[model samples]
Target: MNNRWLLPEYIEDVLPEAAWQVEDVRAKLLSLFKSYGYELVIPPHVEYIESLTGIEGDDLNLKTFKLVDQITGRQLGLRADMTPQVARIDAHLLNRMDVTRLCYAGHVVHTLPAGHFSTREPLQVGAEIYGSKNLTADIEIIELMSSALKVAGISEMNVDIGHVGIFRTICELAKASPQIVDQLFTALQTKDLPSIAELTINWEESLKVAVLALPSLFGEAESVLATARLKLPTVPAIQDALETIERVCVHLATIGVRCSVELGELRTGFYHNGLVFTAFAKGWSNPVARGGRYDNIGQQFGRARAATGFSIDLRDILRGLSTPSGKMSILAPDSQEPELRELIAKLRESGEIVRVDISGGSSDELAWDRKIVKSVNGWEVVSK
Candidate 1:
C-alpha cells in the first residue's frame, strides 16, 4: 500500500502547538502594525499573473505557481509575495494621494522553497509606507522592523543593510549590458571577485576598480560607509546612496539596534531600487525578515508611489522561539440540563477553555486539568 497521507517535500502542517504560536504571534504583530497606524489588508490568495509578478522580475515569476482560471481563462497565480498585491491595492483600489500605510498577514505559496530548510508556504507579515520618498520613510521602516522582531521575542538581531542603487549606478556608468549586469549580480552575491573581474574585463579601469571594491565593502556600518566614501567615485547618485545608508544606520544605532553594511548585498532582487535590509536573529541561519524601497513597483499598478516596507515569515520566527505551552482546558460532561449549560457558557465567557465530553469517553486523551461535576453546589469545577 502507498503512503498517501504523506505531505509534499518542503510542505508540512502547522501542528497544534506551532499553530497556536503562529496565531498568537500573528495577533501581536497585527496589533503592533495597527498601533503604528498601518491599516491591515487581506489580499486574495490568488490573482491575475500580471498583478502578482509584473514588477518583481523573473525571480518572483519563477517562484509563482500559475494556472488558467476556469471561468475567464485568464492566467491565475498563487501569490509568491504580497507586496505586489498591496501595491495594486494602494494604486488602483485606494488611490489615495497621501502617504498610505498598509499591513498584511497571509500565506504566500511558492513553487519551490526559498532555501534548503525553508517551507513552500510561508505566513508573511508585512507593513508598507507609500507616497513617501523621504529617507525618514526608510528609517521608519527599519525601526518598525526592528521593533517587530523584538516584539516577537527575537531581541538580538543584526540588520544587514545595503543600497542596490550603489551597484546599479556603477553598472550604468560602466555601460554594462543586462546580461553582463545579471552575471555580475550573481557573482557579487557570492563575493566572487574572479568572476566579477572576468565579467568586467573589457570595462574602463576606474569602473572595474569600483565594481571590484563592492565585495570588500562589508563590515560595521560606520567603517564600511567611511571606506565606501573613500574608495568609490564621488558621483552624485553613488554618494546619495552611501549617504542614505549612513543616515539610516545612524538612526538605527541611536535606537540600540545593531546593523552592518554590505555593499554587495543585492539579494532583494531587481525591483528593489534603493535601500534594502535583512534581519538575522542570533540563532537562526536564515534571515527572519527582509524589506526595502521599491518605488517603481507602484508604476506597474498605474501609479508611481515611493514605497518602503518589510515582511517577516511567521514560521521562521517561530522556529527560533520555544513552543508555546498548551492552554489548560476544563472538561465538562455533555448534558441537556439548563443549569449545566449555563455554567459551561459562563465558564467560557470568563476566558476558560471548556471542552464538553460529548463522546463520554476516557478523559486520558483530553488535555484538561479540571472537570465540572454535579455536586452539593449546583455545578462546580474540581481538579481532575
Candidate 2:
C-alpha cells in the first residue's frame, strides 16, 4: 500500500493557457518596471529567519516554511513577502546616495488564505521606491501601477485607494478600547456595519453612527465621497487623507483612467503607514494587486526612509487573464546547425520564447507537444 498525500490545499497547479498567461504577465510587468527606472532584483528564496523577522507582521509568523541548515545550523525560512527583502537590499546592499527604485518578480509563501482556492506559494511582481517622502512620489507609484496593470491585459480594472492613517485617526477620536479597536478593524475588513454599530454605543450618537457607517461607505468615486461627507466627522487628518485620494483619482482621470476611492480599506500588513490602494479586476471578488506607503519599514532596517510600492499576485493574474491561449513557438532543427541556433536566438531576442530542437532530427512533434516542449499549435519546422 502506498500512502502519499500529493496535493496541498493552498498550493495550485496551473496548466497551459493559465501558465502561459502568468509568464506573459510577468514579462510585461517587468518591462513596465524597467521603463520606470526600477532596477530588477531577485532575492534568494531561503534566508535566515532574522533577515525576515518583524517584516510582514502576523502573516510572517503563520505562513513561513522553516528548515534548519545542516552545515551552519541556523534556522532558515522561505520568504513570505518580497517587500521586506527589498527593504533589506535598500538599507544594506544598495545604500547609495541617490534614490533607488527596485523591482522584484518572485514567489511568496504563505499559509492559510482567505479564499479556499488561494495559492500557498504566490508569484508576485512589484516595485519599491526608496528615498522619497513627497506626495508626488506616491502619486507616481500609483500612476505607474495603473499603467502596468493595463499592460498586463487587465482592460477594465479598478484601483481603490485608502489611507491607513484615516482609520487609525478616527479610532483615536472614538477613544476605542482594545476590544473595540480590534472589532472595528474586523468590521471594516468584513464590511459589517451592524457589528460596528453594536460596539460604538459608548461614543456620541452622531459619532457612533459615523463610525459604524464607515464600513458601508464605499462605491464609485463621487458616490463614496458623497456618502463619506454625510457620515464622517470634520477631522482635519481624515479630511486630508480623503483629499489625497481625491487627487489621485483626479490625476488618473486627466490621463483618461478611472479609479474608485474608498477610505475604509485596511492593509494586511501595517507596513503602509500612509496611503494604501488595491487593484481589482472585473468579476473578481478579491484584489489582484495591493500596495501602499510604508515610511517606516526602511527605518526598521537602519535607515529612516519613507517608501511606498505595490505588488500583484501572479497566481491571481493567471486566474483573471481572459487570454485564450498561452503559446510559444519552437523551430525544428535545420540541416545546418548554425541556422537553427540563429533562428532560436533571433526569436528569443525579439521577446518571443523559442526552443531549439536538440533531440535527433526525427523527433515526433506530437510527443514533443505532449511534453509541453512547445505550446500546442505553436511549433514550426524548417529544413535547409
Candidate 3:
C-alpha cells in the first residue's frame, strides 16, 4: 500500500453519517440566522497572509497554515478562523455604512488541533454583526448563539463572560513594563496567583495589589461586578467595560441567557478589545461556542466597524451525539413502464426517497422500511 494512504495526524475525512449530522446542524443554524436577517457569505479557503490574519492577530498568525502562492509568488495563508474574512467582507465587499449582519459556514484549517476533541480541519459556523458598539448588539449576538444551541438540542448551557478592557485599563494606570504585563496577563488567564505575585513583586504597592487581586474577581454577574467595582482600578475605560458587562448581563437575564462574569478571561481572540464570551454546554469541558467584540478588527481592511459574533465547531457540536438519520428509501421493482416511472417521479417530488431494485439487488446488505407492490388499484405501500 502507498505510504500516502495513511493521512497526517489530526486530519481525516468526515464520513457519511457524521457529515450528515454536521450538515444538519449547519442548515438549522443558517436557517435560524436567515430568519433573523443575517445574510450568508462564503469566503475563499485561502488568501494573502496579511489580509487573512490582521496585524494584531499575531496569535492567529501562529495558528495559520501559510504557503508561498505559486502564481503570484507571494505568501498565502489558509484561514484558521473566518472572523477576519467576514470583517473584510463587511468593510470592503458590501461597504455598508449601515449595520450589517452576515453569517457563514465553511471548513477552516488550523495548523494544529484547536483543543481536546478538535480536528485540524473543522466546519466553522458563525454570524457577525458590524457597525455597532452598543451593549444591545452584544446581547443580540449572545441571544442568537443561545438560539442555535437550543435548536441543536443543547438544553443546559453556561455563559462565562469577560472584558479585556479591565486588563487594558489596569495596564494603562500602572504603566506596566512589558515583562510585568505579559506575566500578569498569563497569570490572569491561567488563574495562577503565585505567578502573578512573583511578576508584580517589584511593582508599586497600589499597582501590585490591583494586579494580584484580578484573579479572584470571577463569579456570579452581580457579585463579580460589585467586587470588581471596588477592587479594580477606578479608570474610565475599566468602568465603561464593567458597565457594558452589567447591561449585557441584565439584558441576557431578561431573555433567560443569564451568565456568570469572568473578569480574568482573555479569550484566544487576543484582538478582542471589549466584551468577550464563551459558552459551555452541560457535560462538556470546553466551550461549545465562543465570540467577543473586536471593534477595530476591520480597520486592517481599512474600515473600522464595531464587530461581535460567535462561532461553533460543527464537529464539536455533533460529538457525543447520535448520528443524524439520512433519508429513508422505498424499495421498488425495476420497471420501464411509464406508469411506474411516473409514480417514482411523483414519490420523489413529494419528498420520498425511492431506490429501484435492479437484477442484482442486495436486500440482505441494505435495510429499507417499505416496499412497493402492485395491486388492482395500482402500486401500494407494504411493510418490508
Candidate 4:
C-alpha cells in the first residue's frame, strides 16, 4: 500500500465537471467582451517585480511569489492581480494614446491565507476600459459584469458598491492621526467595529458614535442613505462624498442594475478612485469578482490615463455552481486523413470544441475513448 499526499495549500486539482464549468464561464465572458469592441490582451504570468508595484500597494508586495530570473538576473514575480499588468500594457507596450478596451482571461497567484477559503492560485476573467473618466464608463462596466454573471447562469448574485474616496473622506473627517488611521484601516479590513470605537473614545460623543458605526453601514441603497443622514451632518466632506455615491446609486437603479449599496465596503488597492464594487454569489463567502476605477496608476507609468476594470475569480465561481457537461469525441480517420482534418477544423470553427483521434486501430481507439467516457461519466464517443 502506498499513501502519498501531493498538493499545496492554495493550489487546486479541479476535476473534469468543475473544470468544464470554469471554462464555460471564461468562454461566455470572452464572447461578451468581444462583442463590446474590447480586444483580448494576454499578459505573461511572470513580470519584473517593479512592474507590478505601485498598483496593488503593499498587498501585491506581500503576497507575490518572487524568484530571481536566471536569464536576466532581475527579480521576477508571479502576478497577483491582472489590473497592474493591463496598465503596463496600455502605458508601455501598445502606446495607444487613445483609450483602449482590453479583455483577458488568465491565472494569478498569491500567498494563501491561513484557514481561509482563499486560493493562492485562481483563474480570472476581466476587462479594462482605458482613457475614460466619464460616469458612463462606470455604468457600462457594472452592466457588463451583471450580464456576464447572468450568462454564466449565476443568479441572485449581489453587487456591493462603494467608493475609495468616500472611505478616505471619512478618515480625514475624523481628524484621525496617521497611527489612528492605520488602526482604523486594520479594523475596516477585518470588519472589526469595537476597535474603531475604542480609537474614537476621546472624541466628542457625536463624532465617536459616527466613527464607531462605520462597519455597520453596509446594506441596500436606502441603508447607506440612512447612515449618511447621521454622520454627514457632522462632517461636510463625508456628506459630499455620500451625495456622490447616492447619485451613482440612483443612476444605477434607473438603468435597472440592481445592487445592494454598501457605504463602508472598502477593500481595494491604491488605484481605485471613483467607484468600487465586489460581486457575491451564494455558497461563496468571498466575492467571486471585484472591480473599480483606477485613474492614477496609468499616470504613474507616465500615461496619465483614466481606467477602470474588474476580474472574476473563476475558481471561486466554479466551486459555487455547476456547469453543463461537455462531451467531446475524438473522431479517427479511417482512410482519408485530410478529410478528417477538415471535419475537425469545421467543428472547431463552429465552436464545438472537438479533438482528433490518433490511436492505431479501432480497438486502441475504443480503449482510449472508454477511459475518457468513464472518467467524464456523461461524455459520449463514436469512432468511424
Candidate 5:
C-alpha cells in the first residue's frame, strides 16, 4: 500500500515545538496590532468566488481553489488572500463612513506553492487602514509592520519602496498599447534591461529614455529619488509620486529603519494604485511582508475607500528562527484525594504545566520532567 500517513506535496504538519512558536508569534503580533488601535476581524476561510477574487483580479483568481456550494450550487473559493475579504467587510458589513483600522490572523490556502520551497498553506497576519488618504496613514502602517517584525525577533530588515503611479504615468504618456504595456510590465518586474530597451525602442524619445532609466532607478532612497527627479519627465503625476517616496523615506529615517527606492518594482497586482512596499529579512530570498495602497479596490464592493496595509506569513517568520525548546511539565498522580487535586489545580493556576498521570505509567514514558509525591507535610513536586 502507498504511504497512508504521508502528507501532500508542499503541505506538512507543524509539530509541537514549531506550533508553540507560531502561536507565540501570532499572539505577540496581534497584541501589537491591538495596541495601535486596529480592531481584530476574522474573515471566513471560504467565501463566494466573486467576493474573494472580485477585487484582486486574475492573479488571485488563478491562485484560489474553487468548489461548488452544495446548498446554493454557487461557486465558492478557499481564500488565497484575505485582504479582499477584509475589504468586503469594511465596505458592506461595517458600512462606516469614518476611518477604520482592521487586523486579522488566519491560514490562507494557495493552489500552488509560491516558490520551490514554499508552503501552500501560510498563516497570514496583517493590518489594514481604510478611509484615510493621508500619507501619515501609510507611515503608520509601515511603522506597525516594522514593529510587528521586531516583536517576532526579526530586528534587521530592509524595506524596498516603490510607486505604481510612476509606471502608470509613463505608460499613459507613451500611449502604449495593452500588449506592449503587459510585456513591459513583465520585463520591468525582472529588471530585464534588454527587453525593456527592445520594447521601448520605437516609442517617443523622451518616454523611451524614461522607460530605460527605470530599471536603474533603485538604491539608497535619497540618491534614487534625486536621480529620478532629474531623469524622469517632470509631469505632475510622476513628480507627486517621487515626492511621496521622499517623505516616506524621511519618516522611516527618523525611526532608524533602512529603506531603498526601486522605481521598477511593480510586481504587486493591478489592485495597487500608489505607494508599494516589501520588507525582507536577511537569508530569505522572498519578502517577509508586502502591501500597498489600493484605493479603488473597495469601489468594486460599491464603496471607494483609501486603503493601505501589509501582511507577513507567520510560518515564514518561524522558519528564520531557531527551533523552540521543549516545555517542562509537572506530573501529578491520578488519585481521588481531594488535597492532591487541589494542589494540582493550584500549580496550574500559578502558570505551571501540570499533567495528570492517568495511565499510571513511568515518568520516563511521559513528557513530564517532575512528579508530585506525598511528603510528610503534603503533596510536593519532586524530580523524577
Candidate 6:
C-alpha cells in the first residue's frame, strides 16, 4: 500500500485547533500590512531556477530545492525565500518609479532546517520598502516587523541591529586575499578568536586589531559604538558603517522601539550592502525574526532599486504556543423541518457555527458548546 501511514520527517499535519491559530494570525497580520499601505503579493511556488538565484539569492542557493520540469525538460527550484521574488515584482512587474511597499506571506521550503527551527518548511511573513535608502525606510520596516511580533503576543521584544558594511569595509581596507577573507569570515562566524588572530597575523597593526575586535563589538548600541570608535581604525568606511548603525539606532528610539547594536552580525554579506539585524523576545536564544538592507537586489532585473525589509517565520513565533480553542458550535437535530432549517441559516448568517447532528446518539467529531432544543417559546439554546 506504499507506506500510507508514513510521512516525511520535519513535515506534519496541522490539526484543527492549531490550524485556527495559524489562520487567525495570518488574517490579523495581513490586515495590519494592508492598513500600512504595504500591498501583499504571492509569487509562484516554483520558477525557472535562474530567476530565483540572482545575485541577491546567492545565500538561498544551498537552501533551495531543485527539480526537473516535466513539460519543458528544464530545471526548476522551489523558493527557499521570497525576498528575491518580491524584488522581481518591484523591478520588472510593477516598474514604478516612486517608492513601492510590498509584503508577502507564504510557505518557503528549505532543503534543511535552520538552527532550532526544526521544520524544513516555514511560513515567512515579511514587508519590504523599495526606492528609499533613507534610514526612515529601514526603521519603518523594522517597526512593522516589531509590531507584528507584539501583535502575535510576544512581549519585551528587542531588535538587535548590525551592519555587513562594517565587516565588508574593514576587510577591504585590510586588503586580505580572497582565500584569507574566506577563512576570516568563517572564523568570525564561529567566534574562533584563535583562528581570527591567526588569520590577521600578516595585516598591519591597526587593521589587525580592528579585525580581531570585530567579534567582540556587540552589545547595547551606545556601548558597542563607543568601543568601536576608540578601538577600531578611523578609516572612512569603518566610520561610515558606525555612523549608519548609530543613525538606525537613533531613528528606532524616536519611534519608541527598543534596539541594540551587534557589529559581528553579517547575516546578508552575500547581498546586503548596508545594515542588518535580528529580533529576539525575552526568553528565546535564537532570533524570532531577522532581516536587513539588501539594496540593489533588483539590479538583476534591470531596475537596481534601493531596498530594505524584514521577515519572520509565523510558525516559529507560536512554536511553544498551545493550539487555539476549537470553534464555538451549536448542535441541532437533522430534520426536514423548514422552520429549523431557517433557524440554522439565520444563526449561520449571524456568524454562529451550527452543526446538524445526523446520528441519533452523540457524535464525538465536533466539540459543540450548546444544543438547540424545542420550547414553548421559540427554540432555546441549552448548555451541553
- Arranged by TM-score, best first: 1, 5, 3, 6, 2, 4
Ten-residue stretch with the least lDDT total in model 1:
358-367
**Across residues 1-384, which tens digit of lDDT does each residue of candidate 6 receive?**
689978677876777788789878988999999999999999999998887786642467888899999999999999988998999999999999999999999999988887664578888999999999888898788888878887776866788888887777778988888778767776777888999889888888988888888889888899999999998888887888789889888987987778888887765446777888888886565678889899888988888999999898888777756666788899998877777888889999999999888888466688898988878877767999
- Higher lDDT: candidate 4 or 5? 5
C-alpha lDDT of residue 309 in model 1: 96
Off by over 4 Å in 3: 1-3, 177-183
Instruction: Compose the digit string of candidate 4's lDDT tens values, residues 1-384.
Output: 654666886787887767867877788889999998899999999999988766644667877889999999999999888888888889878878677899999989887652257678888789889988887787778878877777777766778888766666666666778678667666776778777778777776766666566667778887777766866435665666677667777876876666776656667565676688888877788777779888867766777688888888777777767655556545444434554556556766876555444454443422223221212433333543
Worst-scoring 10-residue span by lDDT in model 5:
359-368
Model 6 local distance difference test score: 0.84
Quote each prediction's TM-score: 0.96, 0.82, 0.94, 0.81, 0.95, 0.93
Candidate 1 regions off by >4 Å?
Answer: none
**Residue by residue across 129-240, what tens digits does model 5's lDDT show?**
9999999999999999999999988999999999988997898999998788878888898888899989988888989999889989989987999899999999999999
Each prediction's whole-model lDDT (CA)? 0.91, 0.75, 0.84, 0.73, 0.89, 0.84
Error of 6 at 247 (Å): 3.0
Best candidate per lDDT, number? 1
Local distance difference test, candidate 3: 0.84
Worst 10 residues of 6 by lDDT: 51-60
Regarding TM-score, does 1 or 2 come out ahead?
1
Cα RMSD of predicted structure 2 = 5.3
Which of 1 and 5 is ahead in lDDT? 1
Candidate 4: clashing pairs of residues? none
Per-residue error at 361 for model 2, in Å?
A: 7.9
The reply for model 6, stretches above 4 Å from the true place, is 56-58, 177-179, 254-256
User: For residues 1-384, could you state the per-residue lDDT of candidate 3 as single tens digits?
Assistant: 669778878888888777777777789989999999999999999999998776563668888999999999999999999999999999988999899999999999998887887789988999989999877788889999999988876877888889887887777777887666766676787888888878767767877787777777788999989988887777788888899989888887888875888888886477788889999887665688999888878898889899999998877777757776666778888877778888889988998888888845576444478888889988877888
List the candidates ranked by lDDT, beginning with the highest: 1, 5, 6, 3, 2, 4
